[model samples]
Every structure is written in structure tokens, then in C-alpha cells.
Target: MTTMTTRTVAYPADGLTMVGHLALPAGTDRRPAVLLGPEGMGLSDVERRRADALAELGYVALAFDLHGGRYLSDPEEMLARCVPLLSDPDRMRGIGHAALDVLRAEPRTDPDRIAAVGYGTGGAIGLELGRDGVNLRAIGTVNATITGRPGEAARIRCPVWAGVGSEDPIMSPAQRNAFTAEMQAAGVDWRLTVYGGALHAFHHPPVDHPTVPGVGHHPQHARRAWRDVVDLLAECLPVTEDQSEVQGRLLTEPR
Candidate 1:
């Protein structure tokens, strides 16, 4: 397999130091980019690997941080930080914009051709970015069905794909309905997929630390959800010709 270069990037967000994981494709040419957001636990290896995988597929991917590089193992701490942050649209947009600026500043990123994908709390942040009227190519989210504030959803300018486990208590049926309703009311191009028999955080790998109730991993669903996200990106932000050449040279099928 061709080696994709990866790096740790530090930036500022909400008066705190934010660390992001950046992955670049093998070649030096500019390419489409993605802003990856992690779950409430923060930017773990899972998000890093996801960025690497996207880079391998010929895009500049940056796994943006949430808690200034801190991983919240304690459920209470995670909720304490995430609940308020999620509730405040300005805070979410600040975090997203900070990381997005870092990704856009990368020489290899084609800022005009970028997507945002996130999981759990990160997913909510991605949605907030869209609601803030950032011109993203696409938005893909998992395990998050949070609705935006009144009249804010209309600001989203890109297609959105959201996935949630059918059994995710955190994203209940009512929440899903509200999210979809907002999208529909705004006339945004959006789609939702509910993976059957899966629970909250189903798109994540098995956790080594104790997780709160309703959080579990389904390996099969995780991979499928990733494919769904990839499909969204392919539809909205197709790779450039140079990227296709590099991907072909790597002997891997196009993502």
C-alpha cells in the first residue's frame, strides 16, 4: 500500500488550543478535502484512521479536535462539556470554523471542494457549520440527528446525509422526525439512513474504556456507514484527475 502522510496540527478555538489530525494523499497535487469531526470522547485513533483512509482515497482529510486534544473517558465529563457546547450554536460553529480554517490553509486542500463529516457530538458541530451558512460541498453525519435553531437550517447550501442507529436512544424517533422536518422545511437536499438493530455510536469501533448506556459498536454497520459517507463525498466532491491517477497508481479501486 502507498504511504499517506499524516501530521498533528494545533490551532486555536474558543480560547483553547485545538489539535487536529491531518492526512494528505501520496502525491503533492491539490485535491478535494474533508473536515472530519470526532465523537464527544474527542479525537481518538478512530478519527485519525478515518482521516488516513480518506487520504488514501485521494483527498486531504483533517480529523478536527473537540476538547483541545483531551479525550473524555468519564461519561459525566463528556456530557458536561458536550451538552452545553451542543446547545450553543455559536460555540459549535466556532470550533468547526477554527478546524475548517486549518484544513483550508493546507496547501494540498482545494478549499472549494470540501465536505464535513462527523460522528455524535462532532456530527452536531458539522451540522452547525452548515447551518451557519458555510459553503460546504456536502455534510455526512452519524449517530447524530440534532435539529438546528429556528430558520437556521435554510442556510445550509450543500447536500446532507445523516445516519443513526435505529435503536439509538440519544437520537430518538422524535428527534429524528424533528431533524428531518427541519431539513424538509428548509428545502435542503438531505437524506437519512437508520441502520436496523444498531444502537448509539454504532459506527464506532469497540471502546476500550467504559461507555455510558446506549453506546455500543457494530463493526459491520460501522463499515457500511463509512461507505455511505464516501458515497456522499463522491457525489458532491469528486476527486480530481490527478487524484484519480494517484489512486490508480496505488492499485486500489476508486472510492
Candidate 2:
């Protein structure tokens, strides 16, 4: 395995002290960075692991927080917070911008070469960042096909790729159509992948805590969605030659 470093970072957003996980690849050279977002339940080990994996791939990754460092395992509590936040694009943008600031401030991050990849609520935040005119290389989201306000999507300057479960009740077919229509009307480069026979949050692993209805995990689709996100990064925010060579050596070196 590639050597990397991980640390917990605390930043303020949404009137709360947000605690996030920052993962840095091995080496001193600055590299491309990704602002990673977590599901509505908030930042968990799953997102932290994703950030670490991104670092392993030679990208600086920060898994941002949503709930002031608290993981909401209760369905009701999660909805109580996420539902209103999702409906408010400004709030979502605030959260996204705060996390972006943290990511960009890192010396290891190449500010000009940054992407945003988020899941569920986090995915919505990434879209909001795009709509708010953040200069991102790309935006890749899973289970967050959210439509922005009137004519707002025109502000998005980069390509967007979204993945959702075909049977996701939270982001239904109608919602997907609306989101795509907005993107099309705004002349944004966008793509959507629907995982057939899957439900909402299908990209997430099964949690031990109670979840809302219509949320289930599909292992096959989860891996596929992850690959799709990685491909998006590879195309839009590729690592430099030095980092790639280091990664190659790490892969071939004997354990």
C-alpha cells in the first residue's frame, strides 16, 4: 500500500464547528486536490476512508463534515437537518465554500486543479458549489441529482457527472428529469448514470443504524459508482507525472 498521512481538521461552517478528515499523499510536491463530501448522516469512517484512498492515488483529499463533527445515525435526526439544508441552496453553498477554503489552504493542494465529489447530501453541496460559480475542474455526485434555482446552473463552468439508483425515491425520475433539463438549458456539460434495480444511497455500505425508507446498499453498484467517480477525476483532474510515477512504484514494490 502507498504511504500517506491522515489528520482530523476542524473548520467552521453553518454556525457549527465542522470537523473534517484531511488526507495527503506521500511526497512534498503539490498535487491535484478533491473536496469530498459525505452523506446526510454526516462525516463517517466511510468518507474518511474514501479520502485516504484518494490520497493513495496521489491526490490531496479532504472529507468534509456536515454535522459539526456529529454523525447522525437516527433517521429522524438526519432528515430534520438535511431536509431543510437541501432545500436551501445558499446554506449548501456556504458549507461547500467553507470546505473548499480548507482544501485550498493546504500547501499540498494545487488550487487550480481541484474537483468536488460528494454523495447524497454531500453530492447536493457539490452541485451547489458549481451553481454558485465555484471554479472547479469537475463535479461528480452520487445520489444527489438536485435542480438549482432558475437559471443558476449557467454559472457552472465545468462538466458534471452524477450517479443515482434507478429506484431512488428521494431523487425520483421526475427529479432527475428536472435536474437534467436545467443542466441542458444552462448549456452545462453533464452526464447521469442510473443503477438499475438499486435504491437510494445504493453507493453507501449497509449501516448498522436505522435508515429512512427507500435506502439500501448494492455492493456491485457501489463499486461501479466509485469507479465512475474515479474515472471522472482521472479525466478532469489527473495527477502529475511525478505523482503518477510514485504511485506506479508503490504498486509494484514488494511488500
Candidate 3:
């Protein structure tokens, strides 16, 4: 594991206090920075682990909190907070932009190497950033709801890797098929990974609670999905040097 650093960033914009964790790869003068958005439930321990993993791989990972330090148990309450941001593209943009600014400003991060990755509603936020021209090199979305996303999807010039479960009820086969076709037509360098036999929240295995009001977890997909994240980031946002280890490794992976 690389030497990692974690910090909580409180941004004055939108009166939201977002907690962020930065992890750096060993011997890296300035590493790529990634803005990671948490699921609708808020920032969980699993996300923290993901940040640590990203840091280990040599990127400054910022696991952003959308709930502003408050978490809700009921799904309705969670929706209340998340729905607004999803409904209004402007609000989500502000949050994502602020977090991106924080990540880019870090002295240990390279400004040109910034990416955004998100899960669930956060996935929509990542897409919003792509549409707003966040100037990101890449994007990764896990179990995302792609409603109202077609318009913006076409505007995303950056490469996108979106992962959804085969059994995801929220985003049915029809939706997925349509989205895939749309991205293809839009001329966006896009890739979709569908985890077979996986359901919503398929990446959170250690999290299990009946009243949690969220999807069940799957460990296998979690591991595979994270591997994809590392692989994609290395491909999309490489360092300035001409050397390309990341590209070489990605070429080895089966497309």
C-alpha cells in the first residue's frame, strides 16, 4: 500500500460541508486526482476503503460526501436530499465542481489529470459534470440511474466507463439497451460493464441490513469493478511523461 493522506474539506459553496479523503501513490511527485462521489446513502466505510485503494494505485482520490454530514435511514428521506440534486442539474454541477476544484488545487495533484467516478445518484452527478464540460479526462459510473441523461450523454466528450448489474431493477434491460445505443450514436468513447447475476449495490458486500433500504451487496463484482476503475483511469488520465505503463496494461485487458 502507498503512503496515504486523508482530510475533511468543508466548502463554503452551497453551504455544504463535504468530507474528502486524499491518498497518494508512493514516490509520486504529483499524481492524478479523482473525484469519487458516494452513493445516495452517504459516505460509508466501503468508500473510504476505495479511496485508500485508489491512493495505493498512485491517484489522489477524493471521496466526496453529498449529504453534507447528515445521513438518513429511510429511503424516502434519502430521496428527498438526492432527488433535488438529480432533478436540478445546476445544483449537482456546483457540488461536483467544488469537489473537483478541491482535488485539482491539491499541490500533490496534477491539474490535467482529473477524473470523476460516482455510484447511483452520484453517477448522474458525474454525467452532469461531463455534460457541463468539466474538462475531465474520464468518468466511471456504478449502478447508476441514467434517466434524463440522454441529452447530456451526447455532450460528454471524455471517455466513460459505466457499470450496471444484469439484475438491476432500477435500470432495466430496456433502459440499458437504449443508453448503450445512445452513447454509441453520440460518438462518445463509452464502454459499459454489466455484472452478471448482480443486483443494485452489487459492490457493497460487507454492508447488510434489512432496514437499510438499499440494494444487497456482491463482493466479486466489487473487486472486478474497482479493477476496472484503476485500469480506466490509467488509460484516460496518464501523467505528462511519454512513458505509458497504464496504457500498456489496459491493452492487455480483454475489451
Every model's TM-score: 0.93, 0.94, 0.88
Q: Over the stretch 12-83, how does candidate 1's per-residue lDDT look in tens digits?
A: 997889989999999888999999999999999999999999999889999999998899988899999999
Candidate 3: where is the Cα deviation over 4 Å?
Answer: 145-150, 208-214, 239-246, 249-255
lDDT per residue for candidate 3 within 11-110, as digits (tens), equals: 6445777766566666649877888888887777767788878887667888877777655556778878877777788888888888788888888888
Task: Give the candidate order by descending lDDT.
Answer: 2, 1, 3
**Predicted structure 3: clash tally:** 0
* Better-scoring candidate (TM-score), 1 or 3: 1
lDDT (10s digit) by residue, model 2, range 1-255: 548999999999999999999999999999999999999999999999999999999899999999999999999999999999999999999999999999999999999999999999999999999999999999999999999899999999999999999999999999999999999999999999999999999988999989999999999999999999987887778797665565567557597
Considering summed lDDT, which 10 consecutive residues are worst modelled in model 1? 243-252
The alpha-carbon deviation from the true structure for residue 182 of candidate 1, after best TM-score superposition, in angstroms, is 0.1
Where does candidate 2 stray beyond 4 Å? 241-255
TM-score of 2: 0.94
